[model samples]
Target: MGPVNKNTFDIGPALHRAILGAGGHDVAISDSMLASNGAASTREAKAFIADARDAGQTPLKASEVEQIHAMPDKAAAKLVALQIDLDPARSEMVAIAQIEGVWCRAMIDNVPLDARLPIYDFKTCENASPEACQKTILNYGYDVQAEHYRQVWQAATGEDRVFRFVFQEKTAPHEVCVIELGAGTLLIAGKKIARAREMWDKCMQANQWPGYPLGVKRVDPANWAIERWPKR
Candidate 1:
């Protein structure tokens, strides 16, 4: 939760910050303050932070280690069902690129073969069905994430790659599904990224950061609300 470091922008959070109309400076300051204050709320969190500071691999908490040891062998089976390759090297690959006058970096969850090929992101959620997962993706800006990663990879290698999400339920009877973005959704994501970048660039150039709009906005009732309580 360090400062936003306006000099370097991470595509994922930058898009979100811009979309929410949050000024980069304020967001950076706020995040840093929060991180500073909340760094040691839990023993596990403190240990992880210490490991990160020491440049060593962070160890899982004792409880987490125990859980992992006790868990059934379901992950491998689920991946096999999803047709995902079991290459350890493919997991947690970092990609870096400079796009739209900003440095961007992404840690791809998995890439089966060549670095320029298709990428897969693993997500554990409540529902793995396409309809439910699509809603979750949009609500969580995963579409923007797909486009951001795609742009970063393309910028680095000059080749576009397919991005897919491998979603599975967090509970028992873990249902799994692989999802790819539709052309329409990708188009919308591209537009969103463009708008976010535009907003960021404008704010950077002006050297002035503004918060939410200055004037009061009108609030209107929705059709459902009107139907439920019609004016007499």
Candidate 2:
């Protein structure tokens, strides 16, 4: 109803476009946004065990919602196999805090076992193998996300917390994997966050919004593309 600040740097969209390229995956922004919204809504619905009840909260079409709800049973079972609880006390909790003069927010997917232990964030993807999920994390700038959440949690509660990702496949025979970021990974992520924050601060101060880098750039063909070329 009121004026919305359109200039805010949302990590999800910013990182997705930056790292994955606007059209790299043949995914348009509108389509990607819709998928993201649906996924978030599904997570919330599953968290509350209200998938059967129509909450009328998601922007996704009714059919889409039903589809996700139906497919999650296998994935849900995988979570149970791991003994991970989704409805932990602080699940789907939102927290906002100021870090280095930037307002940061995080919605924790779940806090299993005890709150003091590691926090878990659920991710539905094409593959749930540790190797595949690790690639997804890097390709999607999830490292930045890990650092951002860690900083926000510490800022809000003065206690450091470990961040973990629970990845599940979106297709049938839904597999799941739990990934814990080690100390070395977090250290690398911290540097990335600092660099991104610096760029954000500069843009905010200068009131200049720039898109992709300027000037002509050389593009290399993918290895598969090169392989497809004539065998000369």
Candidate 3:
């Protein structure tokens, strides 16, 4: 569907992988647990790390620092703009957008739909440090949260979206920047929702969830839609 919807799907796993991959440890808690108990998991761990990093409590890792070098240059510049846009004084509730579902599970299916507004997602350079992000916008770690929320939003509402991955760079004590991913849209939401439904139906028909890795589950659109069906 749209950028917002597609991003929602990727946010969870992407954030999980980023933390473990960057920190060299598993920081995510099981989503299943979060729903059952009021306990923290990897998602909470990442948020805690982001806040702690911003506060300058935990030290930055060398690998994280090096990862900054790999981000696209343009994405870095856009991040600056995004930070400025969201930095103005406003109500805390309005400033902090509440992301919808994805609270039930960590895995997300790529779905595409159309939307009225384009949702922007920002990711920090591995080495950019927490201080650098605060100087610009909210911590880049929120990128995962943004994406995950968008996914649920798409499911609830069929709308297309543009997922922009703004990459930030650290220049000095009070300066940071961002760039956008070159990809047009992350995924089409309508297509994804249809796919998820198809798979769910198949699972019910066969009495088992189809075996596929994460987003790779094959769903036949013809089963759900009329006219042109997606060829698999």
Top TM-score model: 1
- Could you give candidate 2's per-residue lDDT for residues 1-232 as a string of tens digits? 7444342212232222222222122111223333355443344434432322233222333443333554446545766787755654555667788878877788766554455787777676788889998899999989889888888887887768889897766565656688998898899999988887788878889999899999999999999889989775
- Models 1 onward score TM values of 0.66, 0.64, 0.30
lDDT of 1 by residue, 16-41 (tens): 22222221311121223224554334
Error of 1 at 80 (Å): 1.3
TM-score of 2: 0.64
Q: On a 0 to 100 scale, what is the lDDT of residue 54 in model 3?
A: 53
Backbone clashes for every candidate come to 0, 0, 45
**Deviation in Å, model 1, residue 175 alpha carbon:** 2.3
For candidate 1, the TM-score is 0.66
Q: Quote the lDDT for 159 in model 1.
A: 69
For residues 1-232, what per-residue lDDT tens digits would candidate 3 score against the true structure? 5223222112222332332223223233335434234343347545654554455333223333334333322333444455423221210111222222212232222222224434444444434444554333333334344444455544445443544333344332213333332232233333444455566666767898655466666666574575445543
